[model samples]
Target: MPDISHDFVDECFEPSTARAASADRRMHTELAASLHHLAEAVQTTDGKLSDSLGDFASNINAGRFVRPSVFRHYFQLVTSLSSGDIDATKALISKMNATPPRNAHRTITHFGHPDADQISLELISDGMRLAPISDTLAQDFGTLLEAGFDLMQNALPELYGEITAIVHEILLGGAPHGDSVEFDGASHYQFWGLLILNPKHHNTPLEIVEVLAHEASHSLLFGLTVDEPLVLNPNEDLFASPLRQDLRPMDGIYHATYVSARMCWAMETLAASGHLSVTDHETALKAAQADRDNYKKGLSVIDAHGELSATGQRILDKTRAWMNRR
Candidate 1:
């Protein structure tokens, strides 16, 4: 992961499940790196704080650090450390959960309509027009995630397992429901392994399948950028979004292009798998075509304006090769 000189990014591009899994494991080096900085700052200020954090850091195993809750704590620690607020740092350290993280290293094993306690504090700050999904919708998600992940397991086991390695929790909340940017689902950079989805927007099982691939692919992209961005252009560099009405950053455009094909792959596999009902089979095929069309639309935009990094180019190339072959 350091320098990425060996092209570990291929784990995500060429779609090697094991390599993708390894890439995730390699990402923990970031927590270790973050700790290195924090430890340096706390060393002289508070010996007890230093000893406490030192013990906690030493206890962080590969399994424990992979938790999204721990990821949340990591960022909070960084903020506290940066502000040099020893009292806030101590308070945060005091509240740190050493409980075994609920992030099971598996995909679709858990579906939660999380309470406020489980949500990120940033949710309140977003000012997003959000409503809780109906109980009917909440109940349906378990079935949809189960069925959709089953399809992925049967058709694209590599991607399925890679999802297990990437996503830890599937959560539904803040349903903007086709109104704006977070219409169907989203993966925030701050809450790394959590997929916040809109239960109301996805009307069919096929739609849920597409959203699964769509947002989880976004989570995978987030994990990829733990060390470096996927694009060279700044966030202010806006471009037409294939998925959204508003202009988005170059990175968003790049991700939209790549994940569209991923959504296509999900639908195509389920469509051809002969496991769906007659109606769902037809729906999956239509969805697959829609994704292909959207992917092409986004690809044209990328060809026109993308200023991608080396990591971005390889990923785009692999996406191009995959889409062309199909």
Candidate 2:
């Protein structure tokens, strides 16, 4: 496949530094007001809100009283919520209703596998329309997602919680248009709360777990770096990606490396759990090794070209430490 990294970067245009700074400030103010309004509306209508909504309000209200890192994480969600237009809000509300209640059995729709007729073409913050899936495809995708969910719950519950909270929906789609390289999945900073997956590319449960871990890592970084850039350099130069044949920007390489480390962790966990068949166990081992090697290469590129801010440095250090663990 031809490399389309340059085109992809161009298409996903970010606001200029000055404009972004102003937007960030405005977003913080708007988000705080929005949260208060949502909380008040819920209280007036329902007498009491769900524990999740209650915690959400409490966290936002606690403000600086909470740890800076924790506050920033919640702020990301607040910003996402505040940016939603009326249609987006309605769509989100409908999806939330379909979300399985905590501690309850998950249905096909819980993981975002809505029936064919129920699937609506919604536009994401990045101005791309999410693709709809047929009922047969949704059912097949749901089954794999459930297996992956169970593995995550048993092996990595904390990671699972973070991912589910950040990713409000998982839209099924083909490879992104205009990209010769086939993408198994993609996530955008503007759409910080969604993931788009090519179900055809990831048919196995183990494959699904890898993609989930990878994309969710991007979501986590998107939230943590909302106020700053991960690297100081411009996206002018294209560098070889360790995970793929395409050439990508330093930032993309950083994301790939970070997520590769997470993928390695997931694979190692599954391999050690003895939960897979002999063939599957072998595949996991091979995949884990490949991920580790690519991670190392990606990290080298970052070390050479990245100019991380304080928050970015902390995140990088943590991922490096995770990769180094026995």
Candidate 3:
């Protein structure tokens, strides 16, 4: 395990490939430990399903369980596999077995519904359900994302590297044409390397680029928060979020501040890259200003009511220092 918590905090503010690599190893180690505990629990229940545990372990070692959907299956296994019935465990194990190994160099973006065997997160909180993007929209989404990737790779190579390293797969899922709550992008810690984004928010490469930075920043927070929260405040105490319309917990506000800073950095870097068209350049610059304002606003809220831990304070200090840098 990485001994230095401050380095992890710094990585949250200014990500480097080496720092992200350390986080990756730490995350996988946690995954392995969780799987081991799950295996022990399963062995006491069903022999046949429990027998599959060895292959599951081997597959994990072979890098097969790294895919987001398969990794989510591991979440199901840990939560529900041995708690009660064995039937669901068998089916889930079969789904994990059926999951293809992650392709190393494949493009890391997809659009549409997850496979029928996959377990999608129930969005009771969002009051929205994910629907597949049409083929035309998917094609458009892919084009914009690739262009955004190009801009990031050219302008902020280090940030791009870190984002790509942490975010394995970017899945664009839309809600119906007009159902109320609209989310720009989301990352579930249990689905560590996955990003679920809405295509409506992605009209241009510059727009989508911010979403990439935003959601992947959430992934970075997730990695750091595996063991504990960055802030000490209870989630029951809700505060206004700079990004979302609803009031959020202190933790969510802390997350919003960090993500806003990152997205600001990404947009500023791209706007200054000389790669964008005239209109896109103007939009990027304007977005960067909005992000900067949001970052400061969210940080102020955290300083007031955040009740951050020592580690959280370190992160806030570093972020402040980074923002004030000349």
> Largest lDDT belongs to which candidate?
3
Of 1 and 3, the candidate ranking higher by lDDT: 3
Give the higher-TM-score candidate: 1 or 3: 3
What lDDT score belongs to each candidate, Candidate 1 first?
A: 0.69, 0.60, 0.74
Tell me the spans in candidate 3 whose CA falls farther than 4 Å from its real position. 1-12, 44-51, 62-65, 106-128, 277-279
As a whole number from 0 to 100, the lDDT of residue 299 in candidate 1 is 89
| Model 2 residue pairs with clashes | none
User: lDDT by residue for model 1 over 1-326, one digit each (tens)?
Assistant: 33433366654453456655665666666666666567666788788888767666655543555566566666787788788877877776665644465545543322223443345345445554455655566677767767767777776777778777777776666544475455567777766667767665776656666787888888777766665677888788798887888889888888898898888888887777777889988888898898899899888888888887777787788888888987
lDDT of 2 by residue, 54-129 (tens): 5444443444121112222344444544674434444443444343322222223312344312322333333444
Candidate 1, residue 268: the lDDT equals 82
Could you say which candidate leads in TM-score? 3
lDDT of 3 by residue, 1-326 (tens): 44535555465467677676566656776666666666766677656666686667655655553666766777777656647756777787788778776556424443444442133434323343666666687677778788888878887888888877777776767776677887778888767777887888778777777888898888887776656679999879999898888899999999999898888888877888888899888998898889889998898898788898876787778778877772
**Runs with alpha carbons beyond 4 Å of true place in candidate 2:** 1-30, 33-132, 176-180
Rank candidates, TM-score, best first.
Answer: 3, 1, 2
Q: Give the better candidate number (2 or 3) by lDDT.
A: 3
